[model samples]
Target: MTNTKRKWFIYSLVGIGIILISLLAYCIYLYQVINDSRTSEMDTTKTQLLEQTSYVDIHSIESFHGTNSYHVLEAMNEAGEDKLVFYPLEGEQRQLTVFDMEDMLSKNTLIETWQSSCGSCKLVNVTPALVEGEAYWEITYHDNENNYVMNYHSITDGSLQEQFKYPKMFY
Candidate 1:
């Protein structure tokens, strides 16, 4: 091919390569934006639920028979509302009001404050009484026919410890 023709061909190939790279980068950027938007949306929705809700009733906390396993059940309730008539376990349980919920569900905190007797808990241990080092949470969300449930499972010293998950959707 002539020198002029070869130069034009080379320039054309370079231009096409640049265009392709730019398009690929834009697509990747768009995907990241959409993913981040979904995460932010979920966080906002969770905060709104926390604002409108009130309290949680921990129903059962039991150790698996002859095993280092345990389970806990809790129900979230609106403050100042009376729905059930179950016997008290310890002292009187207090309902969390809107204001209280706001404070507990603050952002940047991995664990909610109301999940424990004290507001302080390690991220590794789902239980407040125990402290963990390397173990972390393995979260699972299930939507069964009846209800939406979540579980935060952690393993420490070969024992499985679980924490109750709040309802995803409120009535």
Candidate 2:
């Protein structure tokens, strides 16, 4: 073969080899980036779960209010008292009510008292919670159309402190 032709053939082979090596290196870099991102996401998820568990202490309470539309969960605080946490099944608002157990048991007239104070909302359930060492009532109720409602009433004065309402559905 001619000398010039032989030189061109060697250069072509070198170029092809360089291209292949570059492609392989790029693939390896992409693999490492994807793996690192997945690991970071998993670590973030684990951390969020741990923080949530530490925030709410789980408790065993029977006859919690609501059907498939809402959820009421009981948790024991650091003071060894039950706290009621209310949230809608698909809504955004969440409420935490803390009171004393003995105060709730002695207040049998709480439902009747709430009925007159809460307008048309019917009393559903009453859970005790303690707020800053002060006992309060976490009242759960529903309107005529089954819309969920919550009221935080002071145990001492029977005055409403906070109220929450959630509609039946969200589009």
Residue-level lDDT tens digits of model 2 in 71-103: 334555566666444333344543334444444
Per-residue lDDT of 16 in model 2: 99
RMSD of each: 16.3, 16.6
Q: For each candidate, what is the lDDT?
A: 0.38, 0.60
Q: Which candidate number has the best lDDT?
A: 2
lDDT of 1 by residue, 91-114 (tens): 344232111222222222433422
In the predicted model 1, the residue pairs found to clash are: none
Question: Per-residue error at 86 for model 1, in Å?
Answer: 24
**Which stretches of candidate 1 lie above 4 Å from their native place?**
55-171
Candidate 2 weakest lDDT stretch, 10 residues: 62-71
